[model samples]
Target: MIVVQNLIDAISLGSVYALAALGIGLIFSIMRLINFAHGELIMVGGFVIYALAGNPMLVMALSAIIVVTILALGMERLAFRPLRKASPPTLLIASFAVSYFVQHVILMIFGSRPMGVDFLSVLGESFEFAGLRVPRLQCIAIVVTLALMVGLVVFFRASRIGVQMRAAAEDFTMARLLGVKADRVIAVAFALSGILASFVSLYLVAQTGTVSYKMGVNMVLIAFVASVIGGMGSLTGAALGGFIVGIVSVSLQAYLPEELRPYRDAFVFLLFIAFLLWRPQGLLVRRASERV
Candidate 1:
């Protein structure tokens, strides 16, 4: 039973990471650009929900989604569009600029102190069953992640836009040549990413019970690492990598000695290094051949 509870904890944590990683992977598939500012969208969504307190959960959630989606679209147009032809390094710097800019804006408005939101308090409730206890939030996290993942798979398989997205993922240049509107597709990708960020923020805020301006920094980092570990451009691999990261993270937290627990992140990186050395190309991405 102890082992079973641990497993549940790991999965619950992993599911959240997977959701964030999927959002990161979606944009990478189309644009080949890592939007470092992605977490800002999450933070923005959280703030929106925080500001609109006392509203129904459904209302706040929808508001967050709508506002973040608009911000994401604007980000693509203003920050990314002009740089479509620039070098990756240039785009990367731009992402950093956007991230810092958003962070400061939030700080200026919300101040340094974290704000509280209990809109989803029901999820914090826990129950015991089969000699084990679990929070309602944990179960919801797992279910939400599973449902979103399955829905994404189905969308990609059955929907027209989804097919275009997969095509872009496989070969953006060729797909564009075949008449895929690169800008439109990229915009759609960002919009989807924003929606995912909102969902991530919702779950994260519910679990942690507080929100701060820089709260998304760590999450975006984990999502980026998960993307790399899973394979740079493989959405499925990204999700897998998130699960790996989450399980390892929780396991370390659960079993590490009290003194060593503080350094668990360092230990997680060690495991990451070992995994990379074993499979540097990642779980699914093909290694590009060197050409003379």
Candidate 2:
């Protein structure tokens, strides 16, 4: 029973990380930019939820999604569009700059102290089925992640804009030459990323009951690690990497010797190093192609 519970916990945490990774991965797929500021999108969403604590859950959730989505589009247009032709290092720096700017803005407004949010308290409680206990949020997280994954798969396969996004990812210049609208595709990608970030923020706050300016820092870091481990530009790989990291992290916490537990992340990275040494291109390597 304990083992089962631990496994459920692992999946729940993995789902959260997977969502974060997917959000990062989607933008990377289109722009080849890591967008470290993606975390700020999550942070902003959390603050939105916190501010709307008096509102209905559905209303708060929708507002977060809308606000974050618009913010993401604004980020692309205002911060990144002008730098589109610049070097990758420049784009990377821009992402970091945006991240800091947003973090400080939130800090100035809300301070460094963590704000408590009592949203979704019922999900924190445990329930038993067939003599096994599980938190309601865990189950919901797993289901929601799976549904979103499936929905994305369908969207990519069946939607016109999705096809254009994939083409742009494969070769942005060529895709543009072939009549795909670069700005529109990139904007859509960022919007999707923001939506994902919103859900991640809500879930994180619900689980922790607190929101902080830097709350998204760890999540974005994990998302980056997952992207690298899964495959740099592959959304599926990013999600897979996130799950791997989440499961390993939880397993380490559960089974490591008490004294060594504090070093769990160190060990996780060591394993990541070993994995990279074995498969440097990642599990789902994107086809090597010249991007103009």
Candidate 3:
């Protein structure tokens, strides 16, 4: 029963990582650059909710999403858009700089102390299923994450804008030639990525019960690893990678020898390295002729 509970916890945790990785992977697919500041965007979302804790829960959630969206758009316009023609290295460095800048700005405004919301306490009041105790917030997290993932898949598969975004990710030059408005598609990708980050921030806040200004820094690293392990541009791969990593991490913490727990991250990275050496294209690479 403990094992089963751990598995469930891992799934819930993995769902959040998957969503965060998807956001990271989506922008990379279109822009071919990792936004180092992506995690800060998520951190900002958490801070927004923390700031708005006195408001109704629904309003706080909406405001968090709105704040993240605006921040993402602002970053795109001010930092990324100007560097469109710059070298990849330049763009990467700029991303890192922006990330640092945002972190310091948050510190200046909110201080370095951790902040939290009471929503989880309100939402987590007694829930049980089949002899297993479960928090209501966890249930909500699972449901909301699944719903967002499904909505994203449908958007990419059926909507015209989604099609255009996919086309842009697959081949920006071709998309531009086909009058797909590459810039608009790129902007939409960032916007959607921001929304995903906001969703993740919400889940993390509920699960952890506290939010630090630096909460997203470590998470960004994990999400990046998840994206790379899953396949850089494949959303499905990112999701799969998240589940794998979550399960492995939790299992190691729960079952590994005490002396080995500290080395769990090393083991995970070794596995990642092995995967890269053996399958550099990733476990779920799209064929050249296939549209991801």
Identify the candidate with maximal lDDT. 2
Candidate 2 wrong stretches, greater than 4 Å? 288-292
Better model by TM-score: candidate 2 vs candidate 3: 2
Ranking of models by lDDT: 2, 1, 3
Model 1 off-target regions past 4 Å?
Answer: 286-292
Q: Best candidate, TM-score-wise? A: 2
Evaluated against the true structure, the overall lDDT of model 1 is 0.87
Tell me the number of clashing residue pairs for each predicted model. 0, 0, 0
* Pairs with steric clashes in candidate 2: none
C-alpha RMSD in Å of predicted model 1 compared with the true structure = 2.4
Ordered list by TM-score, greatest first: 2, 1, 3
Q: Which stretches of candidate 3 lie over 4 Å from their true place?
A: 287-292
